[model samples]
Target chain A: MNTAMLLLTYAVVLGAVAPAMLQRASWVERAPRLAMAAWRSLTVAVPGAALLAGLTMVVPASPLGAPLARALDACVMMMQDSYATPQRVLIIMVALLLSVAIITRVAYGVGVELGRAWWERRRHMAVLRMVARRDVRLDVLVVHHRAAIAYCLPGRGGSIVLSSSALSALGDRRLAAVLAHERAHLRGRHHLLTATARGLRRAFPLITLFATAEREIDRLAELAADDAAVHASDRLTVADALLTLADDHVLPGPALGTTPHDTGQRVRRLLKRTPPLHPVVTLVIALLAWTAMAAPLVAAAMPAVATIGVDCCPTR
Target chain B: MRGFGELEAAIMDVMWAAEAALPVREVLNRLRPDREPAFTTVQTVMDILYRKGWVDRRLEGRGYRYWATAGRDDYVAGLMSSALKSSPDRAAALARFVERMNPAEVEELRAALEAARTGEPPP
Candidate 1:
């Protein structure tokens, strides 16, 4: 129950549980990368928490410091006492749970506001207009000579924009690949996923797990989109389509390419012909992971069974 | 007049139709019988046209009066050249568009261009 004991227990608990949680939440193949990143972020944070716990052992003077210092001392004493009642321990746990809840609520509010701002700033006009021809009725806008540029703006009935220059730069096969890729985005509603992930990240800034999940999921979503493109056309055509656009200057925006996954990843994935998903394997692994997480809490409750039985008799 | 999706055709349409510096509104109205946009929209589109060196705009009244700088044949040729500058596949799109043109359509464009260039017919 002393500060060091409490700190060490917390560190051990967090270090063990965090990795397992990350492993379960992360993409099966990419779990190691997510775990390592999570570890690095946690490593910096855990030491500071341990230091705070260590400092809490020393009582201080001054009216402000007296109350807080005494509270810490009492908490330490309760934790250090081997025979401390389960009810007292439960009280401390409830306080910590409340703190986590408050922090989560604040984070979510921030994320929602930030997400709304991002959605507004990332403007994409659905109507495609060209500066050249007065005729040629078409639904999507096409700039005359500015081919090698294409992007899907997010919204209801969002149109895929392409410049005439882009149309000319890409051969038929490559053009088909580009259309298929953009279509995949439209069909799957990738923009909504990106927006949701961004909002979650803004809200839970401290929890790298949420942000990491969003980033990896975004990349995976793109990969899924690339798969759609491949299905629509040939894999090589999709790869070639990416290569053409890769060299071209990207449209100005934040959500465009901040994430690390790109054309190269898409092409490499296509070349390897990665299995999209194996349903049975995923289900089994998910079940086992959930069981592992639940086991410790169930076992921890066993020691208090006698106390619970005694409480039933009341004052004898 | 109406918003041009392609510059050459737009320029050709303007040149063939207008004898003087017609305002953007006049041009737009001449182009589309179905939907008439505001004067500002037409002017903005015309401004883009002027910037692209597709048409000539002269100061007239409070607004700028516009005229196409290229004749029908010249504009069509420009369109062909611009399409070629696009990807090789665009060359196919252009070729297909061109193949659909009748002899009379080709002759009319040539005649218009010749008339714009020379005041009189060939002797």
Candidate 2:
């Protein structure tokens, strides 16, 4: 009964409460890095808690509260009985199979995405090698396109590509800001975060949590990159470069660049300084995030704790 | 130093520079005057290029002659355009480089570019 209740709580929190709570948590925007960690924890904790809850139900109930040895015997007997009954055996088999399927599916999704990204990056590199000229001064690949485009294809030998239109589009200062933005993406390795989020969302599109997490992570990566860019260049320059590139179409595949959706919001954030999050608030939130992750397992283990207590203590 | 990628690029360069279609042996001989690659290697590369729509081939005698269908500049532009098209999420991809702007903002950018070009103060 305790196991069942725990399972119910886990399901409710994972499927409904967590997603809704996160959606309403406006403060997440202020502390994106911490919020991202919390979201990641929830992603793992949901499945982990569900699995533990299922395992707890499999263990037989001890009414007399036997000691360690007797309890072991009861557990062994219950395990045998669980397989002896066709219905219980089928449930266990289905649960085990489902877990395996979910794990394999996510693994396959991640593998495919990474492989595709690598392949595309290789092809882009090959093409860039042929046509793009080395700009020794700027240390970026200069392509001859009239449309303004600036992006970086990330890898060991990745190059930052800029179209001729981009050179003429912005002044020297604004150009520096754009370069700083692209460098920030490469330095931060934001592509990996976006790719992982994409893989998770693709693997589990039905899960509202994965979808929400992917969107938030995508936005946060841009914000983080913008923050990095702002460090090197002034806010006005970055904001101007952003507006200049806003209308230009982006070259696709695995390349990360300065332009992102929500330019208006980013520009506004850059112009208006936001107060730093309080350290106590950040610490409290971090603790709550971890606690939320651990609570399910703790709930599932309560009966076992009681069993251990009864075994260790003797009542008059 | 001369991998399949380099070989493909070499082949494209020869075809793009040539006035007319070149045969397989001719393409190989033009690649490296010092030490030429095997005929089959060049043939295979050309076939791969043809399949990829980078080059067009026509039956002439025992083997086909290949030529670049697009100019080098057009080919590079196509590559750039295709890269943008290849993004799984167009919005996310563009967001990496720039943010989405409304018509008013785009107009502002156009005006700014014009001002920079004509020596007028930016609006």
Candidate 3:
């Protein structure tokens, strides 16, 4: 019971508070992949810890030295003192309901979103293959559009799509920067991250952690791609490419009313040449994220840990 | 598979340019002179296109003549429409570039970029 309470508290605190703390950490923009890892771990840790805490309530502890399987089986033989009271029985029932609800909802949300995205991409690809010309030398799809647009579709059929106007506007090096950025998105499978974020955020809207995951993941992904683009082309070229496309796509009026947080920030960050965090700091973040993901499972197994390998008779 | 896709786009282009449905012979003729594709290859690509719903076909005389179901503009529009949809699916940015920024933001971005390009501090 104490272990379960500890886990429940951990989940609640992590879910309710982590987002605000993370946003304050300025390194997030500098180390986007790490920030994304942190968010990914938090989403898993919150639900995982909650589900485990609920499991601890529903399943009674086994005899000393018994394994986890034995403990699970012991639940059916509910002659344990833990289940003796009517209140205890009610608590277990509620906990069981919660665990089941969490598992099913998460599964349904992610499954439906992934499937819908796959189907949508298929329909889009069907049209794209027919309309777009394959530029084997550039290794991208080219569409004859006046707008200077660029994008990539992700999956087996996915390729970077560049507009004819965009092709003419950018010089070879500037185009390389843009291509590298899109390729980075594809390589990182950022679409899957964005899709999963949407699923989780919608699944648990009230949970602040899940609620903010989609937007943060999206912004962080673009930053990460920008970072990757720098490896191929200098920051100045990437910034130039961005401005050229923006210049071509700019409309006259307020139809472009502000949700300009990401683009503006990306340009400023590139211009400012924000220094990346130290390698040691990045290593620390990656380790911390892994540890966060692993901790919930350890907490959930606290009871089993107490029972296993304590064969005192053998010691005697 | 790459060859088939290239051929498919090539064939579709001929159909889009033609005033009416053309037989496989006509499509092969319209293709660039650098590479001459076989008549059978053109027929096979149009067959695949018909199945994929990009083009519709009917038997004229002995051979099938294919015409695009939609124009080039419509397909380009379809691709752009999905990218531009304010849906959550586009959260990953189907277009890795712009995401419909306000004109003010675009201006701000251009100013910042210009400063970077010219090595001048922002005014």
Candidate achieving the largest lDDT: 3
Better of 1 and 3 by lDDT: 3
| lDDT tens digits by residue: candidate 2, B1-123 | 248867787777788899989999889878877557799988998999898888899999998988998888986777667555525643222224664456575566555544444563332
How much of the true A–B contact set does each candidate keep? 0.00, 0.24, 0.55
Q: Name the TM-score of candidate 2.
A: 0.73
Q: Is candidate 2 or candidate 3 better by DockQ?
A: 3
lDDT of 1 by residue, A52-84 (tens): 333332221212234333355543353355226
Candidate 2 local lDDT, A146-182, one digit each (tens): 6677777776777688888888898798888888878
Q: Using Cα atoms with residue i matched to residue i, what is each candidate's TM-score against the true structure?
A: 0.47, 0.73, 0.87
- lDDT of every model, 2 decimals: 0.48, 0.69, 0.78
Best by TM-score: 3
Candidate 3, position A305, lDDT? 55
Error of 1 at B47 (Å): 17
Query: Which model scores highest in DockQ?
Result: 3
Candidate number with the higher lDDT (2 or 3): 3
Ranking by lDDT: 3, 2, 1
Which portions of model 1 show Cα errors greater than 4 Å? A1-122, A126-140, A145-147, A249-261, A285-316, B1-28, B31-123
